[model samples]
Target: MNHLLIATLLVCLSTTIRAATATPPPVPDVEIVLRETQPLTFPRGSRLPLYLWTPNFPTADDAELERVLKALEARGIALFARWGGNDFAKASAFPLRVARLQKKLGLETSVDATGLAHGFYNGTPATGHVDKDGKRFFDKSFFWSPGCPFAVQPRYDAMRARLEPWLEKYQDEQLRLDFWAADWEFDGPNEWNSGWASARQCVTCRAQIPNLDTDFAAFQTAVRKVRAEMQREVFVKPIQRRFPNARIGNYAMNPHDGRRYWWDFFEKRTDGLPAKAEHGALYRPWAREFEDCGYTVAMPVIYTWFNLHGEYPFANHQYRWFYNLLLEASSTGRHTTPAVPRVTFVHWTTTNPPKELPKDFEALTETSYEELLWHLLLRGHDTFAMWCPAPELAQEVRPVHRVYAAALEYKEFLDHGQPVLFDVPKQPGFVVSALQLGKKLLIRRTDFGPAPAFFELKLANGTTLRVPKVDGKCLLLTTP
Candidate 1:
């Protein structure tokens, strides 16, 4: 029979784990062994920062839905959110449904207020971007007509109108509205899905903008200013007026890293001279403009876009590169908005995927997927707002649940402890990161390559503890 695991795990670590020759006085040698690792239990007061939000998290009827919800809840998901459920047209239903979810599951809901703001996905003719001919910009693509709307005064008024009902319904405050974010699609001044330069052709552009044809930098700045102001006035401000405690932000609201990455879209200009995506590379970040948006929470969309491999000719990228990208994101958020908490948006699956993986192609393995999850928390982002697929919820997310459950086990260190090692040397065919809490240190070392015989970890107090390898899971250990 499997035995009950206890807090007195040090005894097992001390005895079973093979140790190097000498032991220093203050710090003792130890390594924990996961005997009967199955049926991972949630810590008594689990304050794990892992959140799971499905498409329709709260569907009133089905027994199967409840089963999936309970299973997800059991997986030590500390927070729940509605990624998509309520109608954008009538956002009044949003607050009530979330309230119902909170009452039934006994977990708070992180609101995705995309619809709360008045902007459309692909804005309409009356509201969307209009050229001198009064036609929308980027109005038609091969698959869809992605209309980019300019942030003008009329839309702002409509935003307030749409918000009144949501505001009135949300006054009840039935659920704890802790974290809030908006996945406002086709937002911002861009050359992609929407158009920024197309505004040059706009009649309003001719009137509002000075030297519209020549001064592209001014044009970029102007459009960004209008968009940010709209976001602040329409989405963030109203929510703050009602729910002061809400940690509000918009998705991809982190520090802009310069011009967009290379792709098929408008690579017309090769010279790095102007602040345009067309310029190849020259647009400086609009630091003041980002701050003006008034985001209480810095929500960075840190998805596995490259899992080190996004292109057709697949390449095996190093683990350090991927890990450092996550670190950069977390650090960027902190520097940009030091006062605000970082609630990173994560997707377990690669957002940009190849149509099919060749037999020889090496993408992220299952173990690597788990490691990515750990690194997100290890880098000290407050929590994750995860998006899960609708079908086969339990099985698809079971591995993630394990990672979450494991995280809660050391909630104290994870919450309070600072990361001593961010750039863990990728030597043992695996990657590692360490968190320190006073004398004791907790390490999360996950294997990506072939299983090594053993590896050594040096502590804060100058002690080296050699740890044996574990299979099929993350190797978590604490030094004594």
Candidate 2:
């Protein structure tokens, strides 16, 4: 590859680049492209894609949608609109309308699939309620299951069929599909729910995988193969027929380890995935296959409290694990991986409150918001999604939006990819990581604590510089 071509691809983050005099606050982090590993370009010069959900319920007024869009645009943000599946499945014309508005705002539109198993006569054999081992509970009336008698292949086929015309009409840059809903994932602890890979016992699924035992790994693999075929034959083909340039994606949830209270399934490691894939062993099924079949993956994590603990302990833990998994996935460098790791930060506020959060729990989450932003700034995320909670709690959740707005304003400068040179041999409590984008350098500082560290930066101008902040537990430096 030409140096320019190589620069465009495989942009690495490094720490030892020469710094220039402090100028314009570093160009806003979101617009900074420290590395260009692929031919990826940000629309409107934004780095991270900031998406907000425009749902059908508590229906957003045209004025509200326009207002939010303008706000996001002003802050260098983007939007992702959802079309109802259970309540508005194939009936509402919102997706098309939303797409038109998206085009007007120069925004990329994404459609969400709702009733895979919940709605009537659409597809799959799913009902609003599910029976796990003998106990039963209602699934949020969002998705219809592939196993529902009415769902089967035709039901899913219909979803794709409906999308074809619109996909052609819009030819938007990316598409997102949520084929499975929350009930499918194991709840960790004592919950035995299927987590998206549920319901293989259905007659049609059983007929296909006759010897399918109730093994989590096997069931996951079977579902993966089936879903991929559907995307390839039904969804992808139809979209390609209509618009060949668009990218398609969907959301998946991670399964919790038993110790953390998820319905335990794999006490030992499962099959098909590599041992190294253990960070998020439960959620990688489609992640691996989506890559094989060419699809984008979005993992939505629901941090709902089972018994209403004020601290949002579970949600906090889930967020950390999800972050780790995303970091692992990006570092692996596999394009075939179907999903780009992103977090759909959701807060179920109608019922639960943190027992011991800051007097203002919402404000405390702002710190989390900052941490999340810091992580994304370092890791290079594709998008940041926030889920819509119930109408009553919208006021409380508005702060998150504010924080997102503040973060995006700085995205362009944050993305410039500065270098943090590391002298591995001399550093005692630090480890070095680097990313180089085009002509820029990005170097991260990680201090393991207990001692001092030293590092050197090799700049583009043939000069060597040293990072001076190597004394603390966590140090971050940027090149000028």
Query: For each candidate, what TM-score against the reference?
Result: 0.67, 0.53
Model 1: per-residue Cα lDDT at residue 425:
39
241-298 per-residue lDDT for model 2 (tens digits):
6555455554433212211221112322334332333233333323334444344334
- Badly placed stretches (over 4 Å) of model 1 are 1-49, 61-74, 78-106, 115-151, 173-175, 191-194, 206-219, 255-290, 306-339, 352-354, 358-360, 392-395, 420-432, 445-480
Q: Which candidate is the best by TM-score?
A: 1
* lDDT of all predictions: 0.54, 0.39
Give every collision pair in model 1. Answer: none
Per-residue lDDT for 241 in model 1? Answer: 86
Q: Determine which window of 10 residues in candidate 2 has minimal summed lDDT.
A: 182-191
Candidate 1 lDDT over residue span 215-245, tens digit each:
6566667767767787888877887888877
Full-model lDDT, candidate 1: 0.54
Residue 289 accuracy (lDDT) in model 2: 48
